[model samples]
Target: AMTVFAEKYGVKYLAAVKCLHKDADALLAFYDFPAEHREHLRTSNPVGSVFATLRHRTARTKGALSQKTARLMVFTLVQAASKTWRRLQGANQL
Candidate 1:
């Protein structure tokens, strides 16, 4: 279901799906899940552990991306380029 929704929206679902695995040692290591608990956690239920961690991390990362900054930069560049083009056209006319 999630994979279908992600596909429809062109979003990456690998992280979310991968979190469902009971033995995600590699991922837990990569994310720096505590060394002592890593082994025990491998067999533990991940519903409220890895799944929650992945969801929270992904949300934080996504939320931190500056969409407003990107839009402002694009708008500024386009406006400047259009003004320059119009000036060039006016000069050519004269």
Candidate 2:
């Protein structure tokens, strides 16, 4: 699949193709999991969302946060978000 993509569109997306090639194993590592859990793996954007949330909240504070305060805020926000996250569907497979 990556080979086909590289052949057909690599020229137009050199950087992307390079990254895909470099991290091919990591990117495809999700397939080693159960099929039922693949959806969760594919849609896992929690870290990005958390970072975005942190950025928005911090931007409002206009750089007034100390390192300790920022760390605490991020930890609290992640803990809150984790409460609403979905559970793995095929835990039995593991």
> Which candidate leads the pack in TM-score?
2
Ten-residue region with minimum lDDT total, candidate 2:
85-94
Each model's TM-score, in the order given? 0.23, 0.59
Model 1: how far residue 74 lies from native, Å: 0.3
Runs in model 1 deviating more than 4 A are 1-65, 86-94
User: Taking the tens digit of each residue's C-alpha lDDT, what string does model 2 give over 1-94?
Assistant: 9999999999999999999999999988988887898887788788897788788889999989889998999999888878887778877776
Error of 2 at 18 (Å): 13
What is the C-alpha local distance difference test score of each model?
A: 0.50, 0.88
Question: How high a TM-score does candidate 2 get?
Answer: 0.59
The sequence of per-residue lDDT tens digits that candidate 1 reaches over residues 35-91 is 544444455553454345445654766755477864665455455544533222233
